[model samples]
Target: MPQSHPRPYGTLAVVGAAALGVVLAACSGGGPAPKASDLSSADRAKVSTGGTLRWALDAEPTTLNTFQADATPDTALLAEAVLPTLFTLDQHADATPDPDYLTGVEQTSQQPQTIVYHLNPKAVWSDGKPLSAADFAAQWQALNGRSSAYWTARTDGYDSISSVSQGAGPHDVKVVFAKPYAAWKGLFTPLYPAAATGTADAFNDGSRTRLAADSGPFTLSGLKDLKALDGAAVTAVRNPHWWGAPAKLDAIAFTPAAPDTRLAALRAGKLDVADLSRAVEDGTPVAQAASVPGTVLHRASAPAFLQLTLNGGSGPLADPDLRRAVAQAVDRTAIAEAVLKPLGLPVLPLGNHLVMADQHGYEDDSSALAPGADNATRHLDAAGWHLAAAPAGDAAHRAPAAAPVRTKDGRPLGLTLLIRTGSAEDVQVAKLLTDQLGRIGVPLRTVTVAGDSFFADHVAAGSFDLALFSWPAAAFPVADELPLYAKPAVQPDGSLNNGQNLSATGTDEVDQLLAKAAAALDPSEAARLTTEADTRIWQEAPSLPLFQRPQLVAVRTGVANAGAFGFTAPHFQDLGFTGH
Candidate 1:
C-alpha cells in the first residue's frame, strides 16, 4: 500500500456547507478528480534550512504505534517523519523502493515466491543498532495472525509471509511467501524496531504513547500536554545521524486544532501549514479563505471517502431485501452535491467501494442498486412489509412531518442512524437520508453521539442500524480492504472472527474474488478482480459510498514539498520553507 495513513476504523469528518445550508440543486459541469498531486513543488536547493514547520493535526493520536487499533491519521503523519519506509508509493500509486532505506528490492524466486531486500548499510536505529532481518522477522511474527497475544490493527501482506530471514549479506533480508502475495511491496513499511515487536507485551502496549526507537530523517523530541490544544501535541526534530539527505526543517510541531480554528491560526502566522480537509461546517466561509495573504489553498483528490455503513449484524438491516431497499432509496448524487460542492470540489457520487475515482480500473457499480423511492417501496413490499394506519400509496407518505410507517409481523420498519455530535456535515447528510427513507414509508431516526467514543462504543460494537464514517484508500486496495468486506467466519471455539468487517454480513462469492485479487501477480488482473468484488458488495448493501473527499490544505506560499499530496507519499527529507 502507499505510505498512506493507517486505517482508522470509521473516522468521522466535519465538512462545511453553504451558509443557506445544503442547496439541493442539480449537479452540473463537474469533472473527474485530478490525477496529479497538488503539493507545492520546489527543488531541494531552493528550500532553506533551520526553521520550524508548525503543522496542524486533526486530533491528538491515541497511540504512537501505527499497528494499534486506536491509531489515527496523526499517527501515520508522525511515522512518516520518524520511521523508515522501504518503498514509497508514487502519484500513480506505483510502489518504488526508497533509496534511503533500501538500495534495491527484487523478486528472486518464483516457485515459493521469494523476495530479497538490500537495506541501506548506513541506516541505523537511534541507539546505533543497524536495521536488519531481525526487525522484519519480529514485525512479521506479531502481525501474522497466528497468535492471539499480539493486538495488530492490520495484517494484509504480513499474513502471507511464510518466513523472513537473512539473505546474501548482513544488510540483505529475504522474505518468502506462502502464496503469490502480489502486494508484497506494501509490507514492512515504516518498519518497527525489533525492540518494539520482540515480544507480545512489547508489541501490544509498549509504544502506546512513545516510540521505542526511530530510524529516519527525524526523531521524536517531545510531546507537550495533549489536553492543551494550543500547545504542540507532538514534535519531531532533525536527526543528525541520518545517513541520507538531512531534513531541512529544524523541527516539526504537530498542534491540535479544530477545523474552525485553522483559518485564524494560519492568518496569525502561528501555523506554517494547515490541513483544511475537515474544515467543512455550517455557515463556514471556506471559499473566502483562499484570499488569505501569503498563503495558497491547495486541492488534491484525497485517497479517502465518506460513506454510510449499514449494520447487518441485527435489526431490520439483517434482511437483505430491506438493506437493498434502504440503499436504493438514497440519492447519492444529491448528497454528494450538497456536501462537496460548497467546498469547491468535484460533486460526483463515488461508484466503487474499493477503487477510488481517480485510480485505474475504476467502474461505477451503482447500477447494481437502482436509486428511487418507488424501487425502494417495491423491495419493502416484496419482503412482507406494508404501510400501516395509512394507505400504502397515500400522498401523505411523501411529507417529512407526518410520513407513513411500514410494519411486518407487528414490528415497525424503523431504523436508527448514528452521527457524531459536532459534525455539521454528518447532521446534514443524515437529515437528507431521513427524508428520503421516510418517503418510502421507512421511518428513520437520527441519533447524536460523542465523537471520541463514537467508533469504539457504537460502530465497532454494532450499536446502530446505520452509521456514517470515512475510510482511507491505499495503493493496494485488495490487500487493504479485504478485511472490510470479508465474511465473518466461525472459529474452532464457536466464536466469531469478523476481522474488521463491521457489517456482520457477507457472502462466499465476495470472499473468493477478494482472495484471488490478493494473489494476482498481474496488475490488470488484480484490478479486474477487485472491481468484480465491489459489484458484489454493492449488491449486498453492506455500505454505500457517497463521494470522494478532496484533501485541501492552506500553506504558507514559501513552503515546499508539502501540502495536499493526493496519492503520493510526502518526502519528509525534502520538505522545508524557502526564505523568499
Candidate 2:
C-alpha cells in the first residue's frame, strides 16, 4: 500500500495561478522571445555523450510480458524499453496511433464493420525479422482465444469482431466485426509474433522472454539480474537496430528502492531519477529534496484508483447499509492532506467513476461522497449499530452488540481485513484505517499476509471481508468495468475476474447498461450508459474509493527536457543529461 500525501493547496494554487498567467501573457505578447542557438557548447557536449541513467523503482517486474497480465509500473518501465506499441499515448494523454505501423480503417458502405491497418515500411523486429499483419492477426486471435482473462477488457468492444485477416499487400491487416464499435481504435497496441500462437499453453508458458523482439527504440541486450548486483534492478541497453529516433542514453538501470531509501539515494547523487512513493512524499523527505538546487520534482495525475473492497458473499458485509457506512466513515481529505499534500501532490475528490479525469469516459459530473464524524455515526446507526461512550477509565469506545447487526439480530459483526504486509506503507495504511473504523464501531481486525499468498489464494478465493488494494490505469475504456462487477464473470480459477467489481457486486441494471455501452457505436450513447452504470455502483457502495495516488518522478537538475508520457511517468527517451 502506498502512503497518502496531501498537496499544499494554498501554495500549489499560487504557483499554478502564476504559471497560468505567464502562459496567458505569452499568448498576449507579454514575454520576450528567445533566439535560436541558445544552446551552449557545454550543453551540446553533454547531450552528445550518452550515459547510463540510473532510475530507482519501487518494485521488481513480476513478469516480463505485458499482454499476459496487468503490468505494474515497474513492469511497464521495463516493457517500454523492449516492446513498442502501435501508437503511443502523447503528452496530452491522447492515444496517437503510430501512422507508420497503424493506419485508420475507412468504412465503405458495403464494408461498414471493417478496419484496415498499415504497418510502417521500415518496421522490423529486433531480430531483423519483418513484422507483418499476420503477427497482429495471430496476436488478436491469441488474446481472444487463449488469454481471455487478460484480454477481455481490451477487447470488450471487439467481441463482435468476426475475423482478422491479412490484406493483399505486405504489412496490411484487416479486421471485420459483426457490428460497429466506436472504440475500434483501441485495438492498435503492440502485438505478439505469429509464432507464439501455436497453442494457448505455448503462448503463456512464460518461455517468451525473448518476445522482447519489437520495433521499439531499445531491445534487451540481456536480462542482467539487478538483484544480484543490488537487489531488484535490471539494466537495459539501447537497441542498435531500433527504427525510431535512437534513445539518448546508452543504458538505463532500474533499481528497486524501498520507501525510506529512495530519497537517501537521490540526495547522495547516486540515482539520476527516483520515484517518490507516497510514504516519502508525506514525510519530511520531499521538502528536504526539493530544497536542493539543480533538482526538479514532477508530479503527474494518475488514473490509478485505490479502493476498499468488500466481500459480497453471505458475510457481514453482504449488507448494503453497512458498506455505505464504511464508505462515509473514510476520511478521504485526511488521507489526502496527511498523506498526499506534504509530498507536493494533489488529492482527487472521491466519486463514483473509477476512471481518472484524464482517461476517456470519465464523468466529472458525479459528486464525491462527503466524509464526517456525524455522518459515520448516522450511517452506523441506520445500519443498526450504536456507539456507547466509554466508561470512566477506558478510551472512548463503541459498545459491541451481543449479536452482529444488533438491531436485526444478536451476532458479532466482526470481520477480518486482509492486507498485504509486504511494504511498510501497507502496514501503516492498514493501521490508520483500522483506527478510523474502530471509532465508528466497526469491529474490523487486520490480517496481514505475504504478497504472493494474499493475491494468489486469499483474494482469488474470496476468503476475506475487506481488502485494501490499488489498480493501475489501463489504456482501455469504461466497458472494462463490466467483468469486474458482473457476478457470473468470476471464474473458479485464480485469475482476476473484473477490476471495478472487485467486491463481486451483482447488479442487473449495471450489467445491462455496461453491456449496452460496450456494444453501442455512438460515443454519446455509450457515455450515457456508462454514466448510468457508475451511478448505480456508487449508490450500492461495494467498494469505497480512497484517493487517486500521485506518481512522483525526481530527476537531477542537470537532466534537461525530461517529460512524462500520458499518465505513466516520464520515459527514458524524454530524458537527457544537460550538465557539462
TM-score to native of every candidate shown = 0.86, 0.76
Backbone clashes in model 2 = 20
The backbone clash count of each candidate, in order, is: 4, 20
RMSD of each: 6.8, 8.9
lDDT string for model 1 (316-376, tens) is 8988999999999999989988987777777788888876676656678788777778898
Kindly list the per-residue Cα lDDT of model 2 for residues 1-580, writing each as its tens digit. 1101111111110000000000000111122211101111123335644887787766665445444443345655666566646655543234556654555444442245676777776777776877776776666666554454332213434355677887767777778877655456555354555664435654565323444355566666566332344364677788788766667778877877765676778777878776554544335455665554556666655445566778775477777777767767766556645655665555554454434455544554333344565786787787777654433433355554332222345554567888766545456667777777766667678898876566556766667888876654434445445566675355678543544345766677877876776666555666667667777777666776666555555667676545223343344454567654
User: What would you estimate as the lDDT of candidate 1?
Assistant: 0.78
Q: CA lDDT of 89 in candidate 1? A: 68
> What C-alpha lDDT, on a 0 to 100 scale, does residue 486 get in candidate 1?
83
